[model samples]
Target: MRVRQAKRDQLVAEGVTPYPVTVPTTHSLAQVRADWGHLAAGAESGAEVAVAGRVIFVRNTGKLCFATLQAGDGTQLQVMLSAAVVGADDLGRWKSLVDLGDHVFVRGEVIASRRGELSVMADSWRMASKALRPLPVLHKELSEEQRVRRRYVDLIVRPEARQMVRDRAAVTRAIREVMHARGYLEVETPTLQTVHGGANARPFITHLNAFDLPVTLRIALELHLKRAVVGGIDRVYEIGRIFRNEGIDSSHSPEFTMLEAYEAYGDQESMAELTRELVLAAADALGSRQVAHEQETIDLDAPWSWLPFYDGLSVALGENVSTSTGSDRLRELGKEHGLDLDDDFGPQKMAMELFEALVEPGLIQPTFVCDYPAIAQPLARPHRSSPGLIEAWDLIIGGTERATAFSELIDPQIQRQRLVEQSAAAAAGDEEAMAIDEDFLQALEQGAPPMGGLGLGIDRVMMLLTGAGIRETILFPFVRPQV
Candidate 1:
C-alpha cells in the first residue's frame, strides 16, 4: 500500500496526468493473442500494437523490466520493457510512477521469449489510472465477510469469480434463444407494485414520494404477465428481479433474478416440456447436457421423474399421504419426524413440513413433485381428475426446489376467493401471504384463457450449472453494514 502511494506521489511530482480522462488502446490482451497466433518464436511481428490493462505483476532489473497486465475482461498479458528502446527518462518514470493495479497503455511489438512464452515487447507506455489502495488477497478465498463487501477487488484476483459472470451471461443468451425460437415474447413488468400479489413472500415496502402512497417491491412477476395473456400477448416471458424481504442463505437472496414464463392454452404438462427444454438449453450453453455438482453428475438427458406430492411423501415416510389422510395421522407423522406442527398446522401445511423434511433432501436427482394440495396452491387450478389437488409441480434438483409451475387458476370467482383467503391469512399475521389485488381480479373477469406459468429461480440454476454459491453467481451480493 505504501509503495503504491509513493508511486502516486512520484507521478504527481513528475507533472504527469496520473489518471488521464481518455486512454485509447488498439487491442485487448485477448484479441492480441488471438490475432497474433500466426507469429512464431524467434520472429518479430512487424505490428505496433496498443494495449491497456491493469499492471498485476512487475519485476524490475537495471535496464529491463517485465510486467503482467490484465484487461477489464480478465485477459492477462506479459509485457517486456527495456530502457534501451523506451529511453532512460521514460523507463525511470515507468519504474517510479507505475504500481500494481494502475491502468497502463502499452505500445508494443509481439514476440515470444526464448523460453517460448508469448509476450509484448513495449516501446512506450502511459498511466491511465493510478489505483490508490491495494486489492485484497482473495484469489484463494475471502478471509471473512469481504466476499460481499469487496467483490470488485475479489473479481480481479479470482479468475472463476469473473467466469461465473460470463457463464451466467451465456446461460441467459441460450435461454433467450430458446424462448425466442418458441415464439415467447420477452416482456418487462413493474418492479414496484401496488398490492404485491404474485407469490407468497414478504415484500420490501417503500412510499412513492409523488403519490405519497405505500408501494412494495414485487415479490413475483406472475399477476401482470397473466394480464398480458388476457390482452392477447399469448406467449410471454420475463427475466426480472424479484425482491423478497427474506432470510439470506446459500439458496436465498433478498433480491435475485427470476424467469417467469406463461403460454396461453397451456397447463402443467406444457410447462413441464418447456421447463425441461430450458434446463437442457442451459446445460448445452455450459458445453454439456449434464453438470457435475455435489460429487454427482446430474444427467439432463435422463428421463425426469414426475411424482405426485403425496406419493413422494408416502414413499419417503413409508406411510400413506393423500387427501383422504386424516389430520390425526398427519400429526402423528409430523411428531414421528420431530417436526414443529401444532393445531394451527393444517393437513396441507403438515404435508409440506413432512415432505420438506423427508423428501426434498433425497431429491438430489432432478424430479418433478406434482399435485400440490389445492388449499396450499391458491394460484393453481384444481386438477381435472383430482377434486382437492391443484395441478402444480415444483421442479427439484440437487436437493433444492429450483422452479415452480402450475395450471393457473383463471376463473374470476375462484381467483377472487383465493386472494381473499390469502388476505385473511395476511390479516391473521402472515407477512409472506398475498394481498388481494382488485385489478388482477378485474382482469380475470375479462376472461383470461387457460395458461401455464413457470417461475424459475435464476440464481439457483446458475449455482447448479457453474458449481458456485448463490451469492457467488450474484455480481454484488448484499452484506450487512460494517461497523
Candidate 2:
C-alpha cells in the first residue's frame, strides 16, 4: 500500500496527474477480439488498436514486460510492453506509474507470441485511474457475511459475483420485453404514499418535512396501478421497489424488487398464462430451463398446473380442509405437523399458515395454488362457482412463493366491506392488516374494470435461475452496523 502511495506521489513530482477524468480508447478488448480475432497462431493483423482496462497481472521478462488488462465485463487481454518497441525512456516511467489495479490506456498492434497467445504489443500507455490498495487473491467458498461486507472487492475476485449482475440485467430486460410485447403500458408509481393498502404487511413509516404529515413507504404496487386502471389505462405495469418492515429470511428482504402489472376486463384466472409466460421468459433469458436448489433440481420446462387450495391441503394432511375449517381445527392439524400458531390468528389466517407449512414445501415444481378462502383474499373477486372462495393464485416454485395473481374486486361496496374487515383485524392486533383507504374506495366507486394483476418477486426469480439464496442474488443486502 505504501509503495502504491509513493508511486502516486511520484506522478505529482513529475507534474502529472495520477487520475485523469477520461482516457479515450478506440475499441474495447472484447470488440477487438470479435472483429479481428480470427488471426491464426504466429499471425499479426497489423491493425493498430487502442484499448483501456485495469491492470490485473504484471510480469517482467528482462527485455519485455507482459501485463493482463481486464475490462469491466470480465474481458481480458495480454499487453506486452517492450523496452525496444516503446523506447526505454517511456517504458521506465510507465513502469513507475502503473500498478496492478491502475486503469490504463494502451495503443498497440495485435499479435501472437511464440506460445500462440494473442497479445497487444504496446507502443505507449497512459494512466486513467490509480488505485492505492491491492486487490485480494480470492478463493472459492466465501462465507455470506464476509462477501456482503466486501461486495465491491468480491465482485472483481469472483466471476460468479459479476455474472450475477449480468444475469439480473438480462432477466429484467426479458420481463420488460414480455410485458411490452403483451401490449401492457409500462408506468411508474409513487414510492411514498399517505396510505399503503396494496398488500398485508407492516410498512416503514417516515415523516415529510414539507407537509409535516406522516408518510409510509409503499409495501406493494397494486393500489396505485388500480388507480391507473380507473383512469382508463387498461393495461399498466411497473417494476419497482417495495419496502416491508418484516423479518429477514432466505426468501425475504426488508426492501425488494417487484414486477406488478394490471389489466382491465380480466380475472384472476386470466393472470395464469401471463405468469407462466413471464417465468418462462426469464428462464429463456438465462438460456436454461433447469435449476438446482438444496440437492434437488427444478425443471421449469415441464408444464405447470393449478393446485386447488383446500383440496391440496386435504391431500397433504389426510384431512379435509375447507372454508368451513375452524381456527381451532386448523391449529390442531398444524400441531400434528409440529407447527405452532399464535392464539390471535383467525380461521382464514390459520388455514393459510398451515398450507404454507404442510403444503407449499412439498410443491417443488412450478404450480399455482389457487382459490383461497374469501377471508384470505379480501381484495380478490369472489369465485363465481364458490362464493366462499376468491379468485386468486399463488405461484410457487421450489417450495417458495414466487408471484401472486388475482381478479381484483372492483365493486365499491364489496371492496369497502372487505377493507373494513381488514381494518378491524388491524385494530384487533394484526400489524400486517390492510387499511381502509377511502380514496382507493372512492376510485372504485368511480368504476374500475374487472382486472387481472400479477406481482412477481424479481429476487426470487433470480434465485430460481441462479441456484442462489435471495441475499446472494441481491447486490447489497442489509447488514448490521459495524461495531
Clashing pairs in 1: none
TM-score for each predicted model, relative to the true structure: 0.96, 0.96
lDDT of 2: 0.88
In the range 1-483, model 2's lDDT, one tens digit per residue, is: 999999989887888788887877999999987876777878888999999998888886677899998888998888899999999977887767787788888999998877777888999998878899887753445677878888887787778899998999999999999999989999999999998788899999999999999999999999999999999999999999999999998888999999999999987767888988899999999998887778478888888889999999998778988888888888888899898998888888888888888899988899999989887667888998986899999999999899998988999999999999899889998888898999999999998888998999999999999888888889998877799
List residue ranges in candidate 2 displaced over 4 A. Answer: 139-142
Give the distance in Å from residue 432's predicted Cα in candidate 1 to where it truly belongs.
Answer: 1.0
lDDT of each: 0.88, 0.88
Task: List model 1 lDDT by residue over 121-229, tens digit each.
Answer: 9999999999998765434577535756788877788777788888999989988999999999999999988898788899999999999999999999999999999
